[model samples]
Target: MRINVLQHTPNEGPGSILDWAEVHNHEVYTYHPYQFGHLPTADETDMLVILGGPMSPNDDIDWIKAERKLIKELLDNNTPIFGACYGAQQISKTLGYPVTKAPAKEVGWAPVHLQSHVIPGIPETLQALHWHEEMFEVPDGAELLFSSDAVKNQGFVLGHHVVGLQFHFEPKPNNVREMVVNDFNYIPGSILKQTKEDILATKVPEENRAVMFRILDYLSQ
Candidate 1:
C-alpha cells in the first residue's frame, strides 16, 4: 500500500507512522507543499496522512488554502485519511465545520477519554501530547471519538475511513524534544498545559506506537 504524508513543516515528519508503514511493508512518500509546493497525486496515495504544524488552517497563506481544497476533494472521493493537530483542523474546515480557538491551549501530555471504539484497542483514557490552541469541530454524521479534559473534541471519525486526531500519538521521544524546542516560546497558563522540561522528561510509552499502528492498520484496510 502507498501511504503518503502531507508534511506541513520540515521539523514534523511522520514519526511513528513511518515505523508502522515500514512494519507493514507499505510504501511511504511525503510531500512538502509548505516548502517545495510539491503536492501528491491521488493516483499515488492509497492513504493520506496529514501531519501537524504551527500554522493554523485558517491562515490566509496560499499553500494552506490549497491543502484544504485538496483535502475537500479527497474527502469527497472517500479516500482514507488520518489527520493530526493542525492537519485535523484542516480536515474539519474542509468538511464545512469551523476550526476555532479552544477554551484552553493544551501543550503537554494529558489524558484523552475514548468516546467510542472508533479506533479499536486505544485505551479509554490514554496519555497523549496536546499542542494545539485551535480545535476542530466534529463534522455532521461523524462519530466523536476522543476528548481530553482541556479539549472537548480531541478526535473524530467521519466514516470508516476518515479519522481526525487533535492529539499527538505519533511522536517519538526525539520528535517530542524537537517539537518542544521548536515551539517553546508560547506560555499559556492553562492548568492542562505543562512545562517543556516535564514534557521532555515524560517517556513516550510503547502504547503510543501500538495505538498508532492500530489506527494505520484499520486505515490501510
Candidate 2:
C-alpha cells in the first residue's frame, strides 16, 4: 500500500507508524507543508496519515487551509485517513465540525478510555501521548472512539475509512523528549507548572502499540 504522510512541522514526523509501514512492506511518502508548501494529490495515495503539529486548525496559513481542502476531497472519495492531534483537528474542521480551545490543555501522557462501541477488541483504558491545546467537537454522524478525563472528544471515526485521534499512539522516548524541548512554547499554563521530570515520567505504555497496530490493520482491511 502507498501511504502518504502529511507532516506539519519539522520535529513531528510519522514516528512508530513509519516503522510499522516498513515492517509491513508498505510504500511511504512524506510532505512537509511548512517547508515544501505543497499538498499531496489524494488520488495518488492509498492511505493518508496526518501527523501532529503545534499550530491550531483555525490558523489562517495558506498551507493549513489547502490541507483542509485536501482532507475534504479525500473524505468525499471515501479514501482512508488516519489523523493525530492537529491533523485530527483539521479532519474535524474539514468535516464541518468545530475545533476549539480545550478548557485545559492535555499535555504529557494521559489515560484514554476507549468507547465500548468504537473498538470492543481493545482494552478499556490505554495510556497515550498528548501535546495539544485545542480539541475537536465530534462531527454529526461520527462515532466517538475514545475519551480522556481532560478531553471528551479524543477520538472519532467518520464513516468506515476515516479515523482521527487526539492522542499520539506512535510515541517514542526520544520523540517525546524532542517534542517537549522544541514545542514547549505551546504548552498550556497548567502544564507549564509541571517539572521536566514529571513530564518525562509520562509516556504511552508499550502494550498500547498493539492496539494502534490493530486499528491500522482494521483500517487497511
Candidate 3:
C-alpha cells in the first residue's frame, strides 16, 4: 500500500511508523508543508499518516487549510488515516469538532487509559509521548478510545480505519531528543515538562512500538 504522510516540521518526522512501513514493505511518501508546501490528492494515496508539529490546526497558514481540504477528501473516500497530536487536531477540525487549547501542556511520558473497545490490542493504560497543549472533542460518529488525566480526549476512531491519537506512538529515543532540542522553549515554563535526561530515560517507546504496528496492521486491513 502507498501511505502518503503529511509532515509539518523536520524534527517531527515519522519514527517507528517508518520502521513499520519498511518492515511491512509499504511504499511511504512524505510531504513537508513547512518546506515543500505541497500536498497530494486523495487519489494518490492508499492511506494517510499525518505527523505531529508545533502549529495548531486552527492556524491561518495556507498549507494547513489546504491539508484540511485534502483530509476531507480522503475521509469522504473512506481512506484510512492515522493522525498524531497536531495531526489529530487537524482531523477533528475537518470533522467539525472544536479544537481548543488545553489548560496545561502535557509533556514527557504520560499515561492514556483506553476508554473503549473500539480497537483491539490497545492496552487499558499505556505510557506514550505527549508534546502538545491542544485538545479536541471526539468527533461526531467517532468512538472515544482513550483518555488521560491531563487531556480527556486522548484518542478516537472513526470507523475501523480512521484513528486519531493525541499522544505519539512513533517517537524513538533519538526522535525525542531531537524534539527536545528543537522545541524545548515550548516546555520551558510547563510544570509537567520532563528534563532532557529524564525524557531520554523513558521506556515507553519500546513498549508502544508493538501497539503502533497493531494499529497500522488494523488500518491496512
Best by lDDT: 3
In the range 124-156, model 1's lDDT, one tens digit per residue, is 888998888888999999999899986789998
For model 2, how does the per-residue alpha-carbon lDDT over 140-198 read when each residue is reduced to its tens digit? 88889999987788999877788899989876777778777887765656543565567
Off by over 4 Å in 3: 191-193
Model 1: weakest 10-residue lDDT segment is 185-194
For lDDT, candidate 1 versus 3, the one ahead is 3
Q: Candidate 2, 152: how far from true, in Å?
A: 0.9
- Once fitted onto the true fold, the runs of candidate 2 whose alpha carbons sit more than 4 angstroms away are 191-193
Q: Rank the candidates by TM-score, best first.
A: 3, 1, 2
- In the range 1-221, model 3's lDDT, one tens digit per residue, is 89999988889989999999999899999999878888988889999999999898888999999999999999999999999999999999998888998767888888889888766777888888888888977998898988888778989988988999998989887888898888877765554668766776776557688888988888888
The clash tally of candidate 3 reads 0
Task: Give the Cα RMSD of candidate 1.
Answer: 1.3
lDDT of 1 at 109: 87
What TM-score against the true fold does each predicted structure earn?
0.95, 0.93, 0.96
Give each model's clash number.
Answer: 0, 0, 0
